[model samples]
Target: MGIDACTSRPFRGSEAVARGEVSWGRLAGPAFRPLLTDVYVGSSAEVDTATWVRAVALWGRGAGVVAGPLAARAWEAECPWEERELIMPTSRRETSDEIDVRRDRLLPDEVCFRYGVAVTSPARTAFDLARRGPLVEAVAAVDAVAFRCGLTSAHLLAVAAAHPGARGSVQVRRVVALMDPRAESLMETRLRLVFILRGVPAPVPQYEVRVRDGGLRWLDLAWPRVPAGRRKLGLEYDGPEHRTITGQNRDLLRDADLDDQEWEILHIGAVQVFDERRADQLAARVMRRLNPDP
Candidate 1:
């Protein structure tokens, strides 16, 4: 029964510890720190470059790398993301050889880096996707790049210029022209998109809405919908950006004004529109308010 000094049991993860690891990242638990949510073992260290490539192969585009959505989540960014799921970009001539999945291949204008942990280079991600990404998603990504990641429209434009003959070059230039780096945040941009998608007429962003005797209130999404019967509906996107006491008070006053004027108002958010369970319900509400059944 002498202790075998040379053959100490290698730390094959103990059963209890394995269970402990599994319990991290629960909805409300202190230990709950999500690694890959459904199919990844938690490794405190960033996924080494080799493992990152393997994960890309097995999980395709949904897998969260250390620098993927995890980075945004850890930083607590203001954009709408619930399950650490961030959309990954792929190359025009994407290849599954170097990395397991076909990452949106970088166009000639797209910039990239080797952070050792895989990530879209800020310049590359913002510029390359200026035209291709969903309007809302692109705005958020640009926010992440410019505000959170410290890139600018000029930087993105430079990247686009780098690849004169690349796919989407012209469109990227156009989008850059339209993008406003000074936009308050990604959520604000999505608010603008909500109006576009819901067929609410385009808004004058940062427009001031005022009553004759009142001060100005900046609108998130303002649209003039329908002129029949002296009625109209104005919409706004109330994302988490303005969930504070001050913001709540401001909106309350705005609501009071619209109520007095008989101007219908609509409020939308990522959860109200993007949540699978309630998207239809929200759509119905919008339709009912905008086009009532007589």
Candidate 2:
């Protein structure tokens, strides 16, 4: 297409050539980048999650419904993967290394439109993830979308119940059972999973502790019902926000107040989340603190 015709929007590579707005050779040039196979995005266009989702629709046509991370992203949920996922009914099959296609059946209601592109509903996205993803990741994904979409474990469970005999249904149920809507961050969800997987009793999320001055402090994870009476334990994931001087000073005084309240606080960072062994060790330490005699 002519530079003027590009208009900072995604268009089909064939459409550009057919309309004579641009040559086939120019279509392959740096002025445009491929968002999906045969789908090109103008270099000047803003390519974001919405653009990517809409671009896939151009290639998919009637082949499938956008599912998985793409669907989750369309629902405005934070999905970790960069690749797009589509679900084609068993009747249709398409091939692409760039896109992950799931051949499965979807109820009419499970499919809906977001940003003008057909995608899995929030409930279905969580269901698909729990059914197909690894246990921990499935839980995290479910937590993220559920939190973003204002869904609850009941919503995910209802979707799971609708798809009986589906692959990983048992595992999906287990994940839904453990998912908590109060988790506001991926790291917080992951940290909760670590504690659960290690056989430690789950801590209350966003737990509030009253300070001496009457102001309340909320903790990321807190356990007040430990085995040995009222020994309160709090766990915090120090994300980038904690790196600033203001954040540090506030945390110093907050921790001091928690200390005064006889609370044992444990802090972990992003680096600990990626190390499975270390994460488990940290959870083990917390478990020891929660149950000093056990």
Candidate 3:
């Protein structure tokens, strides 16, 4: 059979073979790729996070609720694709390198269906994600979910309160305190956490200032504390979008305009923001700018 005869959506390999949709021999061929044990998708199917989440749901016979990072992505949060996770009420011996199965009971309020896939509610997803990662990563995850789902600190706190005895409740609360829906990108959140983690006061996110032309410009992060003969400090995280010639030229103009308005803008790239040593150095530089010697 040709590849076109295979099911476009994910299907059980055994079922497909039994139904004569595709022979066992064909499934073993390159036309189909296994997502989970016995769960197969046509090789040409676009397999993104959503596809994997759906596959896991199918593998469980629709008995599991998608949770953790996968749940966060399903909610449109800016989360990096990580291991597929599922929460089941009972223990199962099935094991797969690709999926992390958590055997736990979820409260009724904690589960919801999205696009026909059962997933943890936004609050629960944020609560779960924030509980057990590096503090910076936890904050970023919560910020993304909060920003995308319009979740407030109260919503996160409520979930924390509900799960008081949960493993990472303390960390979850800490993440809630740092959560800011104003964060526009993951790197921006990580950059902000770098400073705050180093005992720097949290800078205002998406800070707005009026330029010489009477138009407003927003800084990714800013400290409006003005010292004598010194301009306010502004920080920006430059991602791949800023590497193009046009983007670089536009940044130069923007920086010049902001400079004219007594704002000292510092642009940081992935290397400076992601590398541990470099991030520490960048934070130190900002501290000096924020507190100049007499």
Candidate 4:
């Protein structure tokens, strides 16, 4: 297992390209040694690897995959949108052998890397991990490979046809058609997963609601789950950055509209999101709203 640069924690699947064959040696400047574990720092030839792409792929792991931008960048594939995180591939599928020592595990539906190590055909890669990735990132990768890198959606569609019933294939097709890479955010994806893991019905994300005074308002999550014919919300993650003085007033007015609509909102702040009491607070509120008795 190689250590992640960010966490320094040992990851499960990192494999050095040539066991101990390469190291920070013979550099003209600073003196350094390999860390007690795996990572090395402070040498200019410091980063002796080919590139970030090769470093990650040539030795990536579980939390690491042929990741989105890195994957495209590896082949000098042009990118259509900026990226949020590096995408890594898993070595689960048999294709790991076919994908090059550094590629990812993929379903026949989601990916297709050549012997040359270029990205897989578009539809295949998208279908493979579109749902797993933050949605926008997923779409951006698709755009990077398709519109920018010259792989076409029609070609990807044909690939999907060959892998019928691939878990995320159909959704991948929809995203291919509707993903507006121009206006998507990674935060929305995290919130969606939060709700999913909490067992709350998914919200209509980025829904625009008009205020009584004619200003436009966008919601992080719009309660789409109808219970007793009302869109009552069980909880809300209210980070302070968005709840500053100006933000507070807007939220107050928005809450008024939501309250009028019979929705109960539980505001969760950054502290609450990470605090010890968060789980208890969220559970109590969600249950209180979902099944109440006088």
| Candidate 1 accuracy as TM-score | 0.45
Per-residue alpha-carbon lDDT of candidate 4 for residues 1-294, written as tens digits (9 for 90 to 100): 322233222211213324442333321124333321233333323342123433343333323445444455443444433332223454443323223333334554454353223344455444443544555456545554554445666666666677677667656776566433222333444444444446655556556666566666566556645556445663455765656899788778778876655665656655543443665565455644555354
* Candidate 3's TM-score: 0.92
Over 1-294, each residue of candidate 1 has an lDDT whose tens digit, in order, gives 221212222211233245563322331243222233233422333444334333432344333232333334333334343222222463433333333233344443332233333445556656545655455665665655566666677888777676677766766765665555544567666655454556654555554566545765555545455546645566677766558899788788788876665566666766865674575566555555556458
lDDT of 3 by residue, 1-294 (tens): 433434556778887777777788888888888888889998888887678778889887788899999899899888754868889878874576867888866889999988678999999998888886788888888889988999999998888777668898888778877889899778889889888888787899999989999988899999999666778999988888899999899899999999998889999888887898998998888887778676
Candidate 2's residue-wise lDDT over 56-136, tens digit each?
777777567888888888988776666688888776667788887768888898999987778999899989877766677
Candidate 4 wrong stretches, greater than 4 Å: 1-187, 194-199, 224-231, 234-236, 243-246, 256-263, 270-277, 280-284, 290-294
lDDT of 3 at 125: 91
The lDDT for every candidate, in the order shown, is 0.50, 0.82, 0.84, 0.47
Rank all candidate structures by their TM-score, best first, as comma-separated numbers: 3, 2, 1, 4
Q: Which has the better TM-score: candidate 3, or candidate 4?
A: 3
Q: How many backbone clashes does candidate 2 have?
A: 2
lDDT of 4: 0.47
TM-score of each: 0.45, 0.90, 0.92, 0.43
Q: What is the lDDT of candidate 1?
A: 0.50
Give Cα distance to truth, residue 177, candidate 2, Å. 1.9
Candidate 4 C-alpha RMSD relative to the actual structure: 10.8
